[model samples]
Target: MTTYLPKDVTDGLHAARKQDMARKSRLRVEADGRSFAVLRRWQGGFAVDASVVPPLRGLVDLFEGSSPIASCLIIAAEAEDGEMHYEFKRATAMRHSAPLDFQKDDDAPVALIGQ
Candidate 1:
């Protein structure tokens, strides 16, 4: 199922972007020992600082069923209002042969992390 960003979340992400537009960068997302997604946002000090600060309750609660993941790259990040907007696409590491169910029209998902 395709999930949408909540209204509150959209606003927060926009605000975060405005607050630190320069810091956002691409991020590689991994879960259960597999690379599951990619997010070309949240790069520099902005992401770092946020990590150090208290986690947002709403942020933590958002995205039910979303795989818990560790990220590299900080990919993309935006903040608007009192929330954060994070956008990430899945990544296929080189180690895997081909992903099932995902059809390819001569285009393959790029591998973002070490296999």
Candidate 2:
């Protein structure tokens, strides 16, 4: 026979699971100047709370805290469990330039030792 959990117990479990997801998620999406916390992410897609973000499509920026992670072209994939899922059509990682030190010049020419 199958057993069912009490309503309160099931609700508590759901709340706990949602909290865990939020805690583990560090990525956020920025679209149209609005930011929304990512609920879950994978190699090809991500999910966010439907209540927090409006219908979004096209290019969006993903960030880990203040650092940019990638630029993605996302298309609405589905909505379920209060979350909106998006599939990435394309994703490009943000590139950073190497730090330069003006005090040292390794390319400078040196005189011959014994000419």
Candidate 3:
């Protein structure tokens, strides 16, 4: 059985705490062309500290560049650390589906039959 020195134990604890804090580092989250700093990231989705804008209840499309990556709904919001903790889910976009176009193009060339 190996014995760890007191200083070594303290250093190990400090290192573990620092790693945990790093996991909670600020992350950028964009929605509707606006970006917010997220406080923490977990499985499924992340949490944002929205102290500037009032939290709203509805579905929001989160985008990366010009393409949308996630569709999240504002599930819960609470006041914490002088800010609103907005939690969202990485859910699918619930919208009406567009009807399929079945009309053929007039400019299309027809293939020769039995040629």
Clashes of each: 33, 0, 0
Which window of ten consecutive residues has the lowest lDDT sum in model 2? 96-105
Give the CA lDDT, 0 to 100, for residue 59 in model 2: 99
Residue-level lDDT of model 2, residues 80-112, one tens digit each, is: 877889999999999777656666668876775
Ranking by TM-score: 2, 3, 1
lDDT (CA) per prediction:
0.37, 0.88, 0.57
All candidates' TM-scores? 0.19, 0.74, 0.40
lDDT score, candidate 2, position 39? 87
- lDDT tens string, model 1, 57-82? 21111111243333322234565444
Predictions: Cα RMSD each = 16.4, 6.1, 8.6
Query: How many Å off is the CA of 26 in candidate 3?
Result: 8.5
| Candidates 2 and 3 compared by TM-score, better number | 2
lDDT by residue for model 3 over 42-101, one digit each (tens)?
555555545444454566665444455567776665665444555665467434566557
* Model 2 misplacement above 4 A: 98-115
Per-residue error (Å), model 1, residue 99? 10
